[model samples]
Target chain A: MKNILIASTSTIHGSSYLEYILDDLATFFKDTEEILFIPYARPGGIFYDDYTKTAQKAFSKINVRVKGIHTFENPIEAIRNAKGIFTGGGNTFILINMLYKNNLVEVLREVVNNGTHYLGTSAGSNICGLTIRTTNDMPIIYPPSFDALKLVPFNINPHYLDPDINSKHMGETRETRIKEFHNFNTQPVIGLREGSWLHVKNDSILLKGKLSARVFEVEKAPYEVESGTELNGLK
Target chain B: MKNILIASTSTIHGSSYLEYILDDLATFFKDTEEILFIPYARPGGIFYDDYTKTAQKAFSKINVRVKGIHTFENPIEAIRNAKGIFTGGGNTFILINMLYKNNLVEVLREVVNNGTHYLGTSAGSNICGLTIRTTNDMPIIYPPSFDALKLVPFNINPHYLDPDINSKHMGETRETRIKEFHNFNTQPVIGLREGSWLHVKNDSILLKGKLSARVFEVEKAPYEVESGTELNGLK
Candidate 1:
């Protein structure tokens, strides 16, 4: 009963914004006329209007009109009547904080569960989990809670990178960080590399994009799930 | 008078834990025979006693004995009576969370400001900031607040690294994340590179080690400060 596109990143190396996934996006939103964009994440201090315009330009190629939820007088109502929704990438802390601040958290979830199409990239994708405990973004701001939409049973670690063997930096690797997260949390986590995503429809959650996503569970050796694998049973 | 050695990391590449800064630590802690180790930020799933033992091994080289606070019957009294204190690194959230959980945040700060000769590495150094907002660690656990010891006016982004120009990873770099942090917070932040530290004696905060540190202030271009530069003026 759900139509969601949870992408690891909106942009990748040597590619334009959403260019790599344009075809997939077109098919994902084919049934919709317009989609509401949540530009609260606003990567790199991008203004909300400017961010929305970028999204609009990208969606224009798909013949789907786009509008930022901020433009609405009643955003709750906008979510209620939206044909589809797209939450773009930025800072996860700021994005989730804004979601809770605007009181859009529950309403958006409710509408999406009722069959409103959804799209999330990067920070947006991270919010489609039970909690934001596995996010790779800095805690630039504190949200009211770490709890997320719970759209998926497990958490998402977007823009996931493998440990650089030659680098001498002492910072914890991406895998180590998620493993440390398992020390305090039990939820499964999917480390979604740049071009990967999860396409959830009803009870089926299919891995999209070309890269295999690293899946981590408590007290278990992490393994990779290929592009065509079903990730719905991860929990 | 304050005596503090706030290092960017406890371990560096190809070196034993605390090896890179042992001499500096010996000088910093020369006045004391024993140090109460705040092993709450146990990195890498190391148990409290085991972490204490590791700290003991490092400090033993300087003829100093280390004991974990968890072994104390009254941690508050231990903090008050201890001749010196060392808070090792692990995860900032867990370290700060346990500090708050044990009601030791204010007491530890009080004792340190009262000439407790405090030393902090990595996550420990992060907590000496105005808030734990600038730490590079993953938020595996939620603390009661991001508010930290405020031992200094500015925040510390320990284990700070420059953006990898060659990497195609789409994740936000360390500098970008801090800029985003400035969008919501006003405090100054010092990006302490590995092998770098801030040696505080009373009011003078001197940057120590082999490398320059990055200084970040709101709306200002982040610039490098040489190893010997005084960081007390950041605020």
Candidate 2:
């Protein structure tokens, strides 16, 4: 049985999302000993250490051996020996670049297909798409290249928001920029609002987060979708 | 007769594209008195001095007057005094960035609509699109930004070429990356191959330059198009 909890955040331990997934993790670890924690998105960022520490503390509370994969010089080996993989969020472009550079995208696909549980956060949730078009980053930075791990069918625009308080220093709104993307592309883009996430297992996607997410398709007005709704084209 | 020529090379007097447009320039300017050159793309580069030297040497042979617009910081004045505008190729991202930063996109649009004869090459050709999605540069390096002058109804990916050599050192193939773009967008993306140019006059797009250009649409296979075909989405 393949089980994957691709989350926007794992800390909902006391909330509905964390409650549901933590219960599942508790049950899964009843037999297994360790779960591999891959923190590839942060790369050299110092702040990501907090995300790693948080995951370590959370998993340790349940007697789960959570190992951080960043220390491994050979990431392929770390991925190979993993029973489960949890990707944290920071910069999806940076993460995807590293993954493509190391040729580990296929390896990751194999790991997911082999029934290894997969978990992801913001940027982590982004790599689960056909392309990183939905990303908030300006498109000029080519990274090493542009082949994202096509874990899902549509593009993921993480940290999605409606209108928020603007300080003027932030420049243009992301919504306007995303509309430009809609103007340029022919496929549907999923604007995954902060705290919202997609969970995939056995070809099923379950939405988890605070509220419904927005979907932007060309030639149509944007619409809101509920959690657990099967998105078009993903199947 | 709007003689709009889109050249593969910005300085056609010296460089060689598949189809030479320098000779055509002389024929086109026989009746015209002045030509306006937009060197915004090659900001801080030597286009103002270098390209003018090239054009001066060549145009003087035919007794034509050519001046680069680097002298006019105000685009309105530049557009008003010129018989035609010649847009040159450079770092397109940089060029569009400057245009957007200076709020000249609308100004240029108005100039073109006013029937000032217009010509463009490479980066200049790219700005004639609704978006700059097809560009190869990493979108974040913002010499100014990724925002573009939306003259055409679609995006332009210039310097477009097939991954002919399959070298590992380079990034993903342009086709694959654009397909990845299709996953998130519904708008048709025009991939103008190297040496290919689009000549637009009075709402008509006439393909010029080499043998053919490849265009990719969402959900459709890539197609080869020859000169004179109308671009689908351009208004």
Candidate 3:
């Protein structure tokens, strides 16, 4: 059975890192003593060690120890022996590139599928999708491929925002970009708002948190699904 | 000598398509009777014919005929013999992918370098940079590479937006994304606000329009450049 928490973001507005979801994380990782943190995303171009320390401080409040995968001699072994897994957010392209370069994609996916508690935030959650096509991040680096861990049947657009009605900027809105993605792809995309998350347990994936998620399908108009709605039958 | 007008957008907020830049275009494309339009970057998922027609309609106002590259059986030949060229905005990834797939990258670069009047909006303008790594569009398709025409020494972030001081969105700001790009690459980037453009005349590239553009350089704080400012010495 697959067990995962794919969150739209690690920190919500006006909150500390991972603070908003700490309670839920504490419950989800109750029996696990430590988490193998993948700080490959390196948010804000921060050093890997500093990024790992940030994750450690957050997990410490929940009485859980966090160990960065980079600290281990073998990342593959770290994933294999991890009681729980957590991947923090940053540039998605770099994260996926590093995952491929380190040959950790398959092992990470396998461990998570085998029922290890997995937590993904932002770029981390993006990899749970079929592809990273819908990411809002710049392609600072080209990954081996846009293919990501197929933890879920569909792709995800993290930190999805609604088009500002009063804004004058002419850049494509998040919704428009997803529509363009559907032009070349058929995979469904979940526009996950900052406060929302998908709780995946076995075959059931339920939308959690305070807000609704926008669901996009090919050749169809996008619609919103309220919190607590199950996404198992979405595709 | 290179004669090109790389615009941030085809249309500004509350203006008809190409209306704002039509006069400048008329002056730049003076003496040119027909323009070969590369509608590969179909904005908003519009068909090539429709997008071409839109360009045709806009250019008609300046008494210039527009022909989509798609209409020609020989795209490379058409580019080579073109009197002028225009590439509208859409998904940068797909546009660049098609350019490579059709083997037009080299020819287009060559023609533009040879002084065939060229106009680019949004995605089109992005390709004038060293790479399309700074584009804000979704990666709907993977290009052969992010390498672009290198018409200019630096990259461009079209439709550049300032960070909203009051907004609570957790996504990386435009400046932050550009900063991230600088972390891996040394190319300087110009954040061209809507209605702003870079007028490339031979070796001189000047910022044109009513708004100031932001300049981001590696290891240095980004600064603003006023309209009519010469970018010839930027690199």
lDDT leader: 3
Clashing pairs in 1: none
What tens digits encode model 1's per-residue C-alpha lDDT throughout B73-176? 99889999999999999888999999998899999999999989999999999999999988888878888898999999999999999998988888989999
Kept native contacts, fraction for each prediction: 0.67, 0.03, 0.82
TM-score quality measure for candidate 3: 0.98
lDDT of 2 by residue, A51-162 (tens): 5777777677567777777666888888888877778765566677678777788888777767777777666767777666666532422355444666666667766657
lDDT value, residue A5 of candidate 2: 57
Which stretch of 10 consecutive residues in model 1 chain A shows the poorest summed lDDT?
A40-49
Name the weakest run of 10 consecutive residues (lDDT summed) in model 1 chain B.
B40-49
Q: Candidate 2, residues B95-120: lDDT per residue as tens digits?
A: 77667766777777776767667777
Model 2's CAPRI class is incorrect
TM-score between candidate 3 chain A and the true chain A: 0.98
Scoring each candidate complex against the real one, what DockQ results? 0.70, 0.04, 0.76
The alpha-carbon lDDT assigned to residue B10 of candidate 2 equals 51
Docking class of 1: medium
